[model samples]
Target: MAANALLKTQSPTFASPNSALDNIVLEYSISYFLIDLLHYLIFFPTDILFILHHLATLYVFLTCRYIIHHGAFAFFMLLILAEVTSLCQNIWTLAGFRRADLPAAAKLYEFLSPPFYALYTLVRGILGPLLVYKMVVFYLSGVAENLIPRWAWVSWMFVIITAILVSIVWVFDHWVDWFKGRNYKAAKKVV
Candidate 1:
């Protein structure tokens, strides 16, 4: 009985192209408007906080180098990155929610929720490998002028590159699915 219900729910016959397009446009427009307002208002204070925290960390790192060892330094950098990422993710989430983008909002909610907390854990876990990779690359490159080691900079560069690649791939994959007239698995599930 459950299988039958699932099959019925999953059936493409229930899906309406016009409705889906309307939903997408509506959600996008709402989110864009809300985010634009948030970008100007709430984000300004958040940005100031981030800047202050970053500057304070830099100042402490410079003046109190003797107190904080290499491991501690690495940990501090990771903390800062986590804070910044969290803030950005929150903004993204708010935009998604405001826009009524259910899937994106759901994903972000799951990421932030206590039961999952996957996004936070994933971000933290990635930092370790990133720090190591950056350290090695920076050491080889022979540039260590900033409070954050060259490794942190390199890791950030890699992160930006990966984000761009993933976004491109996602867009291409979605385009392919659209042209093929196939509902994505997630969208199918929604029906």
Candidate 2:
């Protein structure tokens, strides 16, 4: 849906107004965030990072949907990029949660960790930042001033950069852990 909206736009910038398709996609994303926020609040209340992330995301989507009625192009692009790894991430996370108790889950977790980390790092660390840098540069050039106010774009940048940094740190930690485990196994085998 988001990709379709982006494709339909003749030439999209960060400040493009919300089309009907854009609104539909934005609404779908908004619903996802809202439900996910509630899930976090109910089941994972201690996970403040995810909670705050959901809140910040909701703020961006809601403002774009109702208040500004623009910026869907940038947000939708970011959404598609961010979600590209979600399936793999979710599987890895579920396996991680059950790994200690289930042998099958342990195997799955071990199998998926490296690939998940690599894919996540590539998307969140490299591609995401490049796109956001473009957004920052475009907005800083003051071309979108009439469409998206300074406050809106600034807030969006803050949320996006923060989220990407957190994701990078998370995947980096996994990579470190994976390497350490491999080295431990190799040392034990030599002994």
lDDT of each: 0.42, 0.92
CA error at residue 114 for candidate 1, angstroms? 3.4
User: Model 2, range 1-191, lDDT digits (tens) per residue?
Assistant: 99999999867888998999999999999999999999999999999989999999999999999999989999988898989999999999999999999999999999998888889898889999999999999999999999899998998899889999998888888899899999999999999
Candidate 1 lands at a TM-score of 0.24
Prediction 2 TM-score vs. true: 0.97
lDDT of 1 by residue, 5-107 (tens): 2233321221111133333333343344355545545656556534443443343333223322222333244445455455656765475465455766666
What TM-score does each of the candidates earn?
0.24, 0.97
Please state the error at residue 151 of candidate 2 in Å. Answer: 0.9
